[model samples]
Target: MLELVKKNIHMNRWKTQVDTQVTLDDDFIVPDTMSDIAQVILDSGEVQLEPARVQSEKVTIRGKLDFHVLYRKEEGGLQTLGGLIPFEEMVNVPGLEERDYVSVSWKMEDLNAGIINSRKLSIQAVVTLEVRVEALFDTEAAVALGALQKEDDGSGELTFPQIATKTRAVNAAAIALRRKDTYRVKEEMTLSGSKPAIGRILWMEMRLSGALARPLDGKIRLEGTLLVFLIYEGEGESETVQWLEESIPFSGEVEMAGAVEEMIPAIDLRLVHKSIEEKPDYDGEMRELALDAVIELDIRLYEEQPLEILSDMYGVNRELTVETGEACFDQILTRNAGKCKISEKIQLSGGQRVLQFCHSSGLVKLDQAEAGEDMLSLDGVLEVKLLYLTDDDSCPIQSVTELLPFHYDAEAPGITKDSVWYLEQGVEQLTAVMAGGDIVEIKAVLLLEVLVLQPVCQSVILQAQTSPLDRRKLKEAPGIVGYVVQEKDSLWDIAKRFRTTAEHVMETNGLTSEELHPGDSLILVKEIVR
Candidate 1:
């Protein structure tokens, strides 16, 4: 008889990803307080997502396109205006269920805003939303073997001495938590003496980079730098548009209910919503800028578990029939990070001349990650948009967008074609400057991160049926025998094959351990019963 011990494992059942495009069309009339639009210089936007609702084979996501337009006024100055365009989309996912967990992320693939007239603006945007669904389930794994029961026919209790077994160590990456939440970040900065106070806002751009999160005792500590750039009309006599760039370091802790130390954390964070406004400083002058942002966190935690399972087993004194089956487990291969640098020069056309560089923004798109022999190859493109000041009187500002392709290879030993991976990439640094004539140089540093996982399939003993030994074979067996150790042979294997215990064979051969060498001679002694 065989006694099996089992463990319950929580694992991912099914996961799938799908994307959909959402379009926004709207027209806006200029407010009386703001100047009429002369020429649209640059337009940018971000997506704001709500909680996705899941139904049978379908998911509905609702969000808005928060767009901003910087335009040259008819009176020879720049002004900023923005609004929200709401959208709703439903996508069909084949295996999705109502209770499944879903994560929704979006990017503005294309956004265009032009002046319908001097007093009216036309806005159009195409937003791509990627939805990921995960279903978690539990399974029982036969981990180990325990003591067997005795027969009622005046026989002793069965034990390991009467049977032989082999075991192997198994490692697993068990899921601890999968959740999505939001954290609020509020910060304020005052302008220095070298910079002028704000008369009116023209354009503002804020970016978060180099963010890291650590799991502590029931909380998560996050640290990063917020880059803020502002172009505003100064309150001085000139009333000219002056630019100021500031880097603010932010640190905060988010409350997580069951987080603890030493748990592997793969948390992704992004800016979901943000607000920037001018405020009065201590001297009652509008010299301070207040920033409030909402950051969305997608958290995944895994714990390492080690277990010993019976690989093979057999009876020594009884006829046993053993059954085995395979068990699937998830194990972590590696967590890798690398950087890719992109440098490109773009030439201006249509009689455009660069007066000054305003801002540069980039997005890293990971198109594919292919695994080869002991290596992980990454392919992606860096989409960069450059905004600058122009010398032309009609169009004082112009923007350029370019795509820079990048390929990176990271060392991922022991990776195979059957492995699963997840990638997270972002732009760490970006800069734009005039190289000469009408040529502009753009450089960016991209951070690439990947997590690889391999599924393990192990055969384990499921059940064992035992019966009394055959009396005829026992009578016909020799009382003493001679054996020779072969290559890759163990004392346990010799004993089990000869229907004897390892301890008995070791005692007969005066062996202190079960170690054996090839071509070694040994004597097997067994007492025959009839």
Candidate 2:
């Protein structure tokens, strides 16, 4: 009777599934010109001499003059040679009767002068000097003789090396001059540029076409190569990666200290040649701008992703594949500045399953979508959330049967019901033992698939049962008997097929080896008898 009752009992079970898709935001665009600007100053006019010395032949004369030198920096700051003299243009005048000396004085004046504006003026000048020599002689005859000789000898080389001779000298002094004078200056001027933007100036060649005057106009022509730094932000917590750092030749024009009210137009530039370098950590700091200066920039954009995922997996068992794509942007700047991009991921759960997806790694292009489709065609892992299945006692068949009552046939006397019947009965009993079986507890597992998709935020959930099965027939079916092993059949696979334990098969076959030869027969004992 027990066997018959068991045979009439039933068993029940459940399964869950989930799917997800990711997309990018399109609200962001390249910033416009004039957004990034700051004050700038080029403090000018500091002079330095290489070596200070007098002519070796005129040691006793002690003659030296300063090379009045100065730099016209961007800022209008003055530096001067206060007490030092230029050694190149110094001279000694022969005195008369051993009692006379030459005296010299110097001054500067602007030959061309003009008013630049209400607050500033432009000026250019040449320096001039004067010299005087006077003589005193205790012997009038010696002074007279020296005066007579000075007029006769125009070469100025004294004939007698050790004579007490002095000669009166009067002449315009020689002076050493710089290349040019007068530097352009802007009043309360400010300068600025962009950082963490596309492109870099590789080799800059600048030439001053016109001379700069104090508080006036100046211009320069610039030419160079720019290496473009491709910037990209990720979808999630992943950081922005630079795919390409390339250099391209470019050229443009520059002007400074124009009319104070005149605005400088943004210069348009272009690249003429291409070159590339591998710089992994270059510009890691988004805020720092290298090679600070205002110059026209030309850039070459690349379609490549720099990050390479080494490996990834979902949970402890499931392995995942990764996918990648690249994009780029280009622009110009007067100075250096930095910028940023953002991304996010969402997660949801139901019963014993979870679902997850992310919008990371900047914009998703059509090619990336096509690549994903190709992966699907090639049996590649999908870049979506997985449904994790966790086994819990709360959802036992016995508990399910008790919650949803079902009819069962009574066992007849003398004959036992099939093993399938007994199995069903066991499932019902186990399900009834579970408390409040209506709500099944679910768990989730997250995973990443390297080379498939980076920063893939994924999750799995336990969904509710869709259809309930009858357990009566399951209890009446004949149990599987010993069976021959196939070429690739495993103990776990065989056990699952018969709802039996691997231990039973090992013990029944007396199998000391885990390796099973084809055609080998093994016994199967059913674990869950309905």
Reference-based TM-score of each model: 0.88, 0.17
Q: What is the clash count of model 2?
A: 63
Query: Model 1, which residues run further than 4 Å from truth?
Result: 25-35, 153-161, 236-238, 321-323, 463-467, 476-498, 501-530
Residue 491's lDDT in candidate 2: 74
Model 2 lDDT at residue 236? 35
**255-286 per-residue lDDT for model 1 (tens digits):** 99888878777888898777789998888878
lDDT of 2 by residue, 351-381 (tens): 4321111111111111111122122111111
Q: Which candidate is the best by TM-score?
A: 1
Candidate 2 stretches greater than 4 Å from native: 1-290, 293-475, 512-515, 528-530
